[model samples]
Target: MDSGFDLVSGGTDNHLSLVDLRKANVTGKDLEKKLDEVNITVNKNTIPGDPQSPFVTSGIRVGTPAATTRGFVEEDMKVIGGLIWETATAFDTKAGEIRAKVAELCAKYPLYE
Candidate 1:
């Protein structure tokens, strides 16, 4: 919500949120793949009145349960939201930097211990 991206249905009440990628000038598939490359997992989803096929959707579904379980808090999530925006807005140019930042963030809350 704090990110500049447009929330498909506006404020989410759960761990999941659907992001409309039209304004970001990127496809759901594109963002999903880019995020995956940086170790952030998200799924391509079709938004209302979607023009693209389900395989190449116009939206993405992001969930926070895993991050929450890993001990990420509100500030961490806000940082993540900013990272998502940066990734969407500058997919090619910011990959390496974003990846490094993601690794740093994840390292703070190791999954194993």
Candidate 2:
């Protein structure tokens, strides 16, 4: 593993995995904002190597396999990507609408029976 990347224990079985951002040039806050605009949902995580408190993190990780399994195709991915990008660029103004849209999309393709 690289100095910045920490592998998830047992690997990830879900559509997404959390990645530490200390290695990357971006911050969790910035990445979160960007991902939100494109409809990509991700969680902020703490860098394992950090000496600071873990409660607040400096990394954001995102994935879309779950949505894909739920019937999201390339077009959906594009839409999601756009939303994420937008959110990253302009978070405060677009967060609510983007969240609502994400909900609507999720409703269209439920995860379970």
Candidate 3:
């Protein structure tokens, strides 16, 4: 909420958040690609005042409830945050490395094991 992102509902009191990306100037489609390249799943969504189509929304919705339910703690959340920020800033060069790291983290808390 403090990162200047126009978060829906002013901010989240739950696991999910809607991020308005007009300031980032990157559509949700582009941002979604970046996150997916690193194995992070997210969905594009519309926010208040969004001027883009739903399929190419100007916002992205992200959440951590699944990871948390799988035993990921705050430190893991922090790492995920860094990965996401890295994606936002420099995903083209870091996709492979970030994906590897995400795999490693997920392996540590295997969901099916």
Best by lDDT: 1
Comparing candidate 2 with candidate 3, which one achieves the higher TM-score? Answer: 3
The TM-score of candidate 2 is: 0.52
Scored by lDDT, model 2 comes in at 0.62
Better of 1 and 2 by TM-score: 1
Per-residue C-alpha lDDT of model 1 across residues 1-113, encoded as one tens digit per residue: 77788898887999999999898889999999989987889999999999999999999999999999999998999999888888999868999999999999999999996
Ranking by lDDT: 1, 3, 2
Taking the tens digit of each residue's C-alpha lDDT, what string does model 3 give over 1-113? 44446677877788998888787677899989888878898898998878998889998998988899889997887787667666776677888888999999999999886
Ranking according to TM-score, highest score first = 1, 3, 2
Estimate, for each residue in 1-113, the C-alpha lDDT of model 2 and write its tens digit.
22334434424566665655554455676676566554566876665565435555665566766777799986776666556544554566887887787888888888887
| TM-scores of all candidate predictions against the true structure | 0.95, 0.52, 0.82
TM-score of 3: 0.82
